[model samples]
Target: MSFFAGNISYNTKLDFKTISNPAAFYLTNLEADLDKNKIVILDNSHAFAFKVPGDIFKTVKLPKDNWLSFSYSLNFRWDRSNTYWHSNFFLYLKRANRFFPVIEPILKKNGVPDDMKYLCVAESGFTHAVSPAGASGFWQFMKGTAENYGLKINEEVDERYHIQKSTEAACRYLKDLYKSYGSWALVAAAYNMGQGGLDKQLKVQKVNNYYDLMLNDETARYVFRILAIKIIFEHPRQYGFNFLPRQLYTRIPVDEIKVDTTITDLAGFALDMGINYKILRIFNPWIRQNQLTVNQDQPVILSVPKEGYREMEKLSGAFEYTLSADTTL
Candidate 1:
């Protein structure tokens, strides 16, 4: 039997048993197993799903490092409810199917851990977003930080929104941060709050590690938020999410088109290439404006979709998980 909490029904199984009148009187003496001939068994399988792992993630392991602590554990417990509800965590689960494939290789190639892919989900929900503080894109780099990492961010182009380039840039940034801090937890915290801020905090607090240092709620909760992503997503079956392979969005495939020349109008440029402006934008989100004023100074590269590939808009409605977001890092 399935159970519904707040209109979201969890995949579950129900068991009903009955015995003959004479056998019913022997219930207290009966065995729990199937050896009894008088007992009726209902073996309907709805699939077992739990909103939260029944053990409350007791078996879910965090990265084994010096950083895992009582405070971080508490933070994990506190932050996990956001994932338990059908709303927040389910959205990440659906999108992870799409974005994880894209970002994982870049992180791995850059020598970052595969587990770090959860950071993207935490950063922007894998949505191209502009934070109120003016951070942008998948990795959520602010203006100066992005430019420092070699992402072009200006009126006509903002490669911070570019998945490939920005992911590579993030890998590089994380690599540098990891070198200095020697801890992924601290690197993540430093990513949220600048390296300078983290340095100052470490000095003031006299704490050498991220777990021991007290920080603003945002930075303090940051690593645990990421851990929460790690737990629910890595074990989606335990977290009560059930979807067919087709229902999950997969990696978007496209052909790369390099543009070094100035294009007065990108719409016309897209049409000449046999796709609409919207499709072009979906492919080349880094192209921020309708017009591209490209010159020898900097070339604008675009990822135009291959012949058979479809944008999310063109895909079957049933296949997509349409939802909203609050993309704050």
Candidate 2:
């Protein structure tokens, strides 16, 4: 198959031996021009073309009263068009499938708007990431804020890395923000830039609306970034992200084990549980060290594969002995 662009003709044959770089070849030749005005003919029998839709922005939902003007459009297009941003957005979409099931319920139970989950996508890309400013987790809660929102943060454990607990803390924090601002848009802005900064901006600008108030560059673009993520996530194919169901990440099913006692050797404990140290930490990233110190009053819950421990043990072939589930050391 051959396609013509201007006067240049390119063959779309999948001959790997002839093509030195398959990726570059496909990107340079096979991808559509995306030009609104010109249509390229493929061979002599088939032709196809697409243009940017007239009501593209209107098709995706945004908050009715909030700004969806030029600023929002710019951010949306940047997210859709920039190669780096587009790849990350595709990854965020795949990760969302693994996380939203865990996050959305917490948002709903706390009365936060369902759309607010995208704020998390904006915050940390649904990963347990720690910002240089000390914000951590999928919700990106800082140390003091995470503590204030009832997340346990300390040397041995940081619930900021715990998805469910951190999401709960986020819901609490978001509810408080909503109480103060009475607008989800402002709540999002406040979430990005501290409540104090946003308050100062509102007071200085004498404007209650997020769109009306001027903020620092990061804070100014924060909500719009979130809105863009929401739009792209809702309509991924429209923004050029395509994936099969199997290509996306998924939540692993696990059994929660309650521990009220300390374990001195986490690696040994993992082997005793018929798994490995890496798998244990993968499921429980909040475990900061090789040892877990527990108090009887506040037991820590650990997640393990529900029915695959034996399979994992066989696959690993490294365990010499297996202890009872009640073993804490």
Report every candidate's CA lDDT: 0.67, 0.69
Query: 1-329, model 2: which lDDT tens digit per residue?
Result: 11122343333323334534211222322333332323445445432222334464674444446555544644554544334475676678777777788888888998889888889988988777778887887888889999998988766678887889998889999899999989888999999989998899898889888777767878777776776666556555444454545556666678899999999888999889877887787778777778989999988899987675436543353221232122232
RMSD in Å for model 1: 11.0
Tens digits of per-residue lDDT for model 1, 1-329 = 12223333433321212322210112232222223343333345233334333454575434445435744555554445343444666566767766776777888888998877878878888777778898888889999999999988767778887888999999999999999999888999999999999999999999888777889988887877777667556554444444444555556667878889888788898889878776777666677677888787677677777777644455434233211133111
* Residue 44 lDDT in candidate 2: 54
Query: In model 1, which runs have C-alpha deviations exceeding 4 angstroms?
Result: 1-86, 296-299, 310-313, 316-329
Error (Å) of candidate 2 at residue 288 is 0.3
Span of ten consecutive residues with least summed lDDT in model 2: 318-327
lDDT at 138, model 2: 81
lDDT of residue 285 for candidate 2: 75
Residue 322 CA displacement from its true place in model 1, Å = 12
